[model samples]
Target: MAGKGFGRWTVHGDGRGLAPGAVVAPDERLSWPATIGIGAQHVVAMFGATFLVPLLTGFPPATTLFFSAIGTVLFLIITAGRVPSYLGSSFALIAPITAATASDGMSSALGGVVAVGALLAIVGLVVHFAGARWIDIVMPPIVTGAIVALIGLNLAPTAWTNVQAAPFTALVTIAAIVLITVLFRGILGRLSILLGVLVGYATAWIRDEVDTSKIGEAAWFGLPEFTTPTFEPALLGLFLPVVLVLVAENVGHVKSVSAMTGQNLDDVTGRALFADGLSTVLAGAGGGSGTTTYAENIGVMAATRVYSTAAYLVAAVVAFALSMSPKFGEVIATIPTGVLGGAATVLYGMIGTLGVRIWVQNRVDFSDPVNLNTAAIAIVIGIANYTWVIGETRFEGIALGSAAAIIIYHVMRQIARARGTSQEAASPASAPAGTELNRGEPQH
Candidate 1:
């Protein structure tokens, strides 16, 4: 039967009239309520990463929170609000920060990270004028692929190290994440990481592993405590190697973002880089650690198909709000280390899978001699001699692997090109009969 409605309606395939009670879908182009909801979702997705940096680096989570908001806003403004480049605590500098804090303390370590960010901004300017052509020339697929693979490989040990702290709890956490990711689809799958962390934390708490004393002691609201930058030659030297590696990693990120947005990013690359650099500088001054473009958030954007500047703006706002309350930061920090470890295992493993995906998407031909040799040498050199010593200073982990892979690939490419030229020269020329002499083909 035809139904009368208060709002405009149309008949459907079954010839049933639409009713006024039916929910109306919002328009995609301009819907304020829907946009805010989507933006909040982006905030929720990156909350873990935004706070984790400070917890690990011995910086005030409040300060990390403050700068994360400031940095993200700057990133959005500099990009002219076009590309959704979410800025947060970078996992790339985790090892460096760990080593620095162990040797010289958190303040000095943060200073080194600030310096590295400035260096990245400088490189970004160079890339802006030169365009992406230089990126390909300097860091080819072989180099990038190896570096990405090594990033996951190097982090794998750290994940295990975290697991060893509480074997049973860590195992449970990892299992939960994997199961959720595999069994669920859409929003459920997207929330798997958060759910795993929550479940693992609950288990640890029930086991009397969590210590909430810090949370209770923390003030309800406090200004972010800032620290002055202290110069230390040893800390700077220790961090320099990693700084170089991070620059290369940053280039890969720029490339990935460009590919994702299908935008010619060269125009905005310099500005974005400058904003990132400035953010790092501010983070260090504010008693926070390094900042980098969060790749996990990139995956979030890809999965949700939500591409809007306002989403990141909302995330930034949330980060800022969290920064003002010490109690809130303390609560987040109270998550048992074992729980974080379990979740990290799944996160790091997915990063490795992404590297494989990149190689596959590029359609890399492993059967070809040049390709085989390039890949073989890169993987072996990256994994085997994963540490390097420059003068008396020893650079270890992913930094060494990245440098080695880049160097090896360039040399291999040169050798391959020369071999190809020589082979062409050695081949016999075509005869007057219109067939190549070497093939023994008949005259046409």
Candidate 2:
């Protein structure tokens, strides 16, 4: 039913419990109580990273949350709930936003965001009509895997920075997550990230790492500060490259969810992109950070094995409510860096692993030097946080790595095929198990 995609979620089983090895599908939900708990878990999973983008870029955190929640709802509707994702403040926009704000002010930076969003929405429309086949031709399993893996690995330093702030607290959080997964059964075990953060937060509080002073001064209810965008053609260069990163992120998100849920979500890729673009446009029009599909929430879904979009809807509503109350947002913002570091320690690594899982599932033939080198170069570039600057425009790790993966894969493959050396020189018998060298046109 169309309603299933909108409001009416079919209860998974009796809506009480998930049987062993069974997942709650996108259109299905557990009981209201269980679904709400899962939904809140998704919010917790997203909160640290989502808010951090705005906090770092000097955007209002509550305002970012407000648009993030709205973006998520738009994504659900646009995709007809087939894709489970949360539109959080995208880290890829950070450099450009900072530069734009520094030179042209916050409103000018927002104008850059609106420009990117509009462009992305246009790309989404193209993909929706033309189909995602070009994506496969351009970004085969090897390239896709490289992009996905590098994205997570690229954030390793950010996690380390937080760990350095409070090593002991970070360690405790990590240990809590590890133990929770094995020590408990069912939902308790699945919610290790949420529970681990709580454990970490308690530890931080006891160790005097948390400050409650701001919470008391915050209002119980109020609107987040909003600002209108003003377009500057000069800033467009800084923001345009971001569309490439957002495209990679959105596509990787669809691929990741498809792999995890055993569902083919390629058909919804355009809708996903359009939804996020629309969300970002809304954010830029008001005062909020530009949005992208979040990998942190992907980590949560992997751990919980629940792909229900219903939970995402619940999470969006909860986030929207929290955005309306400064006190609530402040309380959440008080989550110590150490706790985030610890959770990120687990979540970030999981994201990298998902990319590898993509390779494994697709049987990517790394024996082909083209495939091997693509992953090799891109992953290193991303993990090392490579940067290239062109005047005011900057292409960071994710952008550089994503571009390198596509360029390297196609250029190398085309050259190799022209020379009739598509297969590696090594003996076929020496190829790794479950991998085969393709001598003909590559098939995704």
- Give the top-scoring candidate (lDDT): 2
What is the C-alpha local distance difference test score of each model? 0.61, 0.87
User: In candidate 2, what are the lDDT values of residues 55-130, reduced to their tens digit?
Assistant: 8999999999999999999999899988899999999999999999999899999999999999999999988999
Clashing pairs in 1: none
Could you give candidate 1's per-residue lDDT for residues 1-444 as a string of tens digits?
A: 111211222322222221222211111111444445545545544566677676776777678778888888887776566556567787656666777778778777778877777777777677667765555665655455655555655566666778888888888887887787667654455446667777888899988888888888888988888887776777666665555665655554554444444343445555666677777777777677677666556555544444456657767876787788878766777777787678767665655555554454444555555555555665555445466667535676556666666666567557767677322111111111112322455322
> What is candidate 2's TM-score against the reference?
0.94
lDDT minimum window of 10 residues, candidate 1: 425-434
Clashes of each: 0, 0
Estimate TM-scores for all models: 0.74, 0.94
